[model samples]
Target: MSEKPLESFVGVVGKETWWSRIEALEAAAAEGRRCGWAARQRHAIELTIARLLRAPARAPNAAESEIVHLAGLLAASFRGLAAKGKAALHASLHAALSGDGALTPIFHQMRVAERHRRRGFSVSFAGLETGAAFDLAISRNGARAEIVCDVLSAEDGREVSRQAWRQLADRVDPDLHAWLAAHPGRYLLKMTLPQGLRADGGGENASPAHLQARIRTLLAGDARAQQDETAVLRLDPLVLAGTDTSQHGLLAQLRGDFGPEAHLSVTVAGQGVFVMAARAAREDDVGTALRRRLAALSGARLSGAAPGVLAMFLEDTDLAEWRGLRETLRLEGAARGFLAGAEARPVAAVSCATRAELIGLPVPQSAAGGEVRFANPAHPAARSPELAAAIRSAE
Candidate 1:
C-alpha cells in the first residue's frame, strides 16, 4: 500500500472526498454520543467538523492536509467545551465560524462550493459606517449578486424615523425615477407596501414577495426625494464621436457637472467609473450619492463599486447616460477593449487613453521584453476580417 499525496485528490473526487470526510466526522460524533457524551457535545463536534471539511483542496500540499487535521482537532475540542458547559468557548467558536462576529464559516462554504462549480448567485454589499452587517450569499446552485443598502430597524421606532434608511432611499430614488421616465414605453413602474415586520400573530409571516414589495415602495419614495433635490438643475446629454477616440468626453461631462477639478476616469476592464474631487469638495458624499443614483437607474443590475466609484455593465438597457459618457471619453483618449461576452476573448482594442492610471501596464513593445502574450488574443475579433484589419491598421 502507498500513501497518497493530497494533491492527487485535487481534481479527482474532490467534492466527494469533502462529503465523505463530513460523513465520517458525523458518524464519529454519533459514536461519541452513544458512548455517554452529552447530546450538545456531540452536536457541537458535528458542526465544527462539518464546517472545517467543507472547503475543497486548493492545491496538493502537505500543509493543507495539516490544516484539515487541525480542524479535526478543533472539532474534538468543541466536544470537550460542550461537555464542560463552557458557554464562553462555545460562543467564541460560533462567533469564529458563523454567528454575527464570524465570517470564516461563510468563507469556508464559498471555498467548498467553488471547487464544485462557479457560483451563480453570490453577491457582496459594503457595510454602512453605521454598524449594519453587509450581506453576501451563495445560492444552492452557486450564482451570486450583491446588494448594498442602508440598514432599517424592524424593532420599536417608526419605519420613517430611521435616518439611515431615509438617506439611502433618498439617494436611490432619482435614478429610478429617471429610468422609469426615460423608458416609459418599455418599462413599468410599480410600488407596494410590505406587511409589517412584526407579525400580528406568531411564526414568520414575511414572504419573499412581501419583502420585495417593501423594497419597491422604499425606492419609489426615495426617487421622489431625489427629484426634489435636483429640481432646479436640468440634465443635458453629452456626446462623443471621432476616430481618435478616448475617455475625454466622460471627463468633460463630469467636469461640467461636478466641476473641472473633479478627476474622472472609467476602467473599461472592470466596467467602472471612478470620480475624485479636489480638496474641500466632500468627494465621498458626492460619490455615494451618485452611486446610489446609478444603481437605482440600472434597477440594481450594477454590482458593488468602490467608494467614489460607480459600475454598470455595457449591456444594461438604460445605458444612455453611460453610453453618452463612454463615447465622450472615447473621443478624449481612453484605452478601450471589447470582449465578445463575459467569458469571451477581446474583440476590439482602444488605445489606452481614458485613465492611464487604471489600465494595466502597457504591453511590452517587443516579445523580447519577457512578456507573455495572451493565447488566442485575436480569436473573437479575427473572425471579422474588417475588424481584424482595423486592429492591425491601428497598430
Candidate 2:
C-alpha cells in the first residue's frame, strides 16, 4: 500500500517479463491472422495494467487488486511447481490465456484458498501434490477439510447455447441486411428450436448454417412462416406497442418480450429493419445443472477421506439472473437438494461464489451470513472449530 499499485505489482511479478510474453502471444496470433481468446486475453491484461497505472494515488480497488493478485499468484506458482505438477498447471495456465478457456476457474480456486488461509488454515493445491482429484487441502488446528472449487456456466442449463446463437446471428446478419434493404419494411423473425440451434452439429440437430438457410428460405417465400420437426420459423411485422422506434428502444422492447432465456437480435439497414427472436422448445433449469455438477464432482473429484466442501463458482452469469436465482431461492433449493442426496455423503457443505464476489464486491453477501454456506451439521467436521470457517452454516 505504500508504493504506487503499479510499482508494487511490477515488483511482485516482473512487468516487463509478463508483458513481453503476452506480446509474443499476441504477435503469434497476429501473424496467424486470427483474433481469438489468446489475443483477447492479452489485450484484457494490458488494459488492466494500463488502468492500474492510471489509477489515482489512493487505496486500490477490485480491478487493481485483482491484477496484482493474479501476477503474484502466477509468479509464485511458476516458481514453486515442478515436473508433472508444473506441466499440469501449465495446461490450465495456457488455457487461462489462450484457447476458448477462461481464467475465472483458476482465479476462483485461488480466492477460495486465500479466504481459508486468512482464517488460519494451511492451504495447498492438494491435487497437484498428491495427484488427488480435489483442488485444495486446508487444515486449521489439526482438523483438515478438502475443498473442491469448480466453475459452472449458466449456459450449461440452457436449451439454447450462447455460442450457437452468436454463430447464427453472424451467419444471417449480412443476408438479413440485404433482404431488409430490398424489402424496406419492418420485420421480425420468431423461432422455436425443438432440437436446439447447435454451434457444433453434423446430424439432424439444428446447425447454425442450416438455421440461417432456413430463415433465408422463409424470407424468400411469400408464406412468411414455416414449421417442421427441427424448428418453427415465422416472419412478421415488427411492433413495439408503446415503445420508442430507435434501435436501442426496439432491441430493449424485443428483449422484454422474449425474456431472459431467449436470444434476440435486430438488424437495421437504411430504415429497413429486421429483428430475430428465438428460443428452444423448453427452458432448462439452471439450478438443476448446478446440482448435476455437484453430483458429478462427488464421485469424480472427492477422495472421501475427509469432510469435503464444494465451492461453486457460478460463471457466465449476469447480475439480473444471479439475483433471480437467489431471490427465487433456486440456488438454495438446488444446493439443499444436492446436500440431501446420497452424493452429499462425503460433502460437509456447499458454498457459492459469484463473479461479483470474485471481483471484490460480495453483493448481498447473504443475510444467511459468512459466505453463502450450507453446512452439513451431521458431518463430524461440521462441529470442528477449525473447519467452522468453511463448513459452518449461517443458516
Candidate 3:
C-alpha cells in the first residue's frame, strides 16, 4: 500500500487495477456534460480523496468520518465486481449517477453483503453476473444462501408523498418569498393533505400546481385560513419559540417540533420568515408497503433451491420515524408477518436495514448490535449453526 492515504484509497478503489471501468463510470457521468447524483457522488469521493492526499495522517475526526465511511463503502462495493461483473457495475453506477435514488438499492445490497462477510461468510455477486433476479450469493462452510435485495420507499403507504411535498415546497418558494415581503411578518402555513398532494396531480386538485394556486389565493386574500375537500391550509403567526444555530440544529429543533412524519420546510426573506408544514390526515404505514413489496418480489427473485435471504432496505425515512417503527415493533411485526405468509416459504431469513445503516453509522447511532433480522424457524436450514450467522435472526 502507498504511504499516501489518497493513493492508498484510490488503489483500494482499483484506480490502477480497474481504471478502464472507472473511466467507464466517469464516461457514463460525462454524457452530454451531465451531472446528477452519481456525478455528485463521484465528485464527492474524488474530493475526499484529494483532501486525503493533502492532509497529514492523524486520528480520524468527525469531519473525516463521512470520508472514511464513504471510502470503505465504495471500496468494498466496487472490489466485489472487479473485472467480472461489468454489466452489473455499469447498471448500478449509471442508476446512482443519474440521481434517481438508485444508490439505495445498490448500497443496501453491498451493506448487507458486508455484514454477512464480516460474519464469516464468503460472499459473491453471482446474481449480478448471471443476470439472476436476486442480488447476492453467500456461502458458509458447506451451506450457501441466496439473497434477494429490494428497497421499499416510506412514501408508498402515504396519501401524500414526501417527494410531492418537496416539489410543492420548491414550487412555492418564490411565491412564499414574495408573500413574506408583502406581509413583512413571520408566518406559519400548516396544511393537512387529506385528499393528498401529488407532484403531477394527474390533472386533479392534488397537484402541486393546484396547491400553489390555493396558497397564492390565501396569501393574496384577507382570509387567514382556507379549507376544502382536498386540503386544509391555515396561516398563523410564526411563533417558533426556540433557539439553535449550529449545523442541523434548527432542523433538529424543527423536526423535534413537527415530529418525524410531517413534511416541513422553512423559507426566510429579509426580516420575514415563513414555515410550511404538511402531513396526511393519517399516519404513514411504511410496514404495509414493506409487506406488499415482499409479496411482489418473493417468487420472482427467490429460486427456492437453497435457503433464501430477502434483504430489504427501507428508504426516505427520518431518524424519528425509523426509531418509532422499531420501538413500536411495527417493523418486526411486518417482517414476521411476511415470514408466516405463504410467499415466505422460500425465505429462510428476512433482514431489514434502514437509511442509517445505509450511511454506515456506528453502534448506538446505528441499530443496536446490527440490522434487525428475523429467521423463519419453519425453514429446515434455519437452525443450522453454520448458516446461523447468515440466516438467523438478531431480533
Who wins the TM-score comparison? 2
Ranking 1 against 3 by TM-score, winner: 3
Candidate 3 accuracy as TM-score:
0.79
* lDDT of predicted model 1: 0.28
Worst 10 residues of 3 by lDDT: 31-40
Give TM per candidate: 0.21, 0.83, 0.79
Off by over 4 Å in 1: 1-86, 95-99, 104-395
C-alpha lDDT of all candidate models, in order: 0.28, 0.74, 0.72
Stretches of candidate 3 exceeding 4 Å from the true structure: 1-84, 99-101, 203-205, 222-225, 240-258
The alpha-carbon deviation from the true structure for residue 164 of candidate 2, after best TM-score superposition, in angstroms, is 0.7
On a 0 to 100 scale, what is the lDDT of residue 193 in model 3?
Answer: 83
- Residues 225-313, model 3: lDDT tens digits: 39887889998887655665332565567777887777777777887878888888888888888888888788899888888988887
Clashing pairs in 3: 38-97
Which candidate order results from sorting by TM-score in descending order?
A: 2, 3, 1
Report the lDDT tens digits of candidate 2 across residue range 117-211: 78888988877666889999988778888999998988788777766776787678889888877899898889899987667854666888888
Candidate 1 per-residue lDDT over residues 143-255, each given as its tens digit: 22222222111122211112222232333344444544533322212211122122231233232233333344533554332222111111222233333224465545545
- Displacement of residue 192 (Cα, Å) in model 2 is 1.0
**Candidate with more favorable, higher lDDT: 2 or 3:** 2
How many residue pairs clash per model? 34, 0, 1
lDDT over C-alpha atoms for residue 47 of model 1: 43
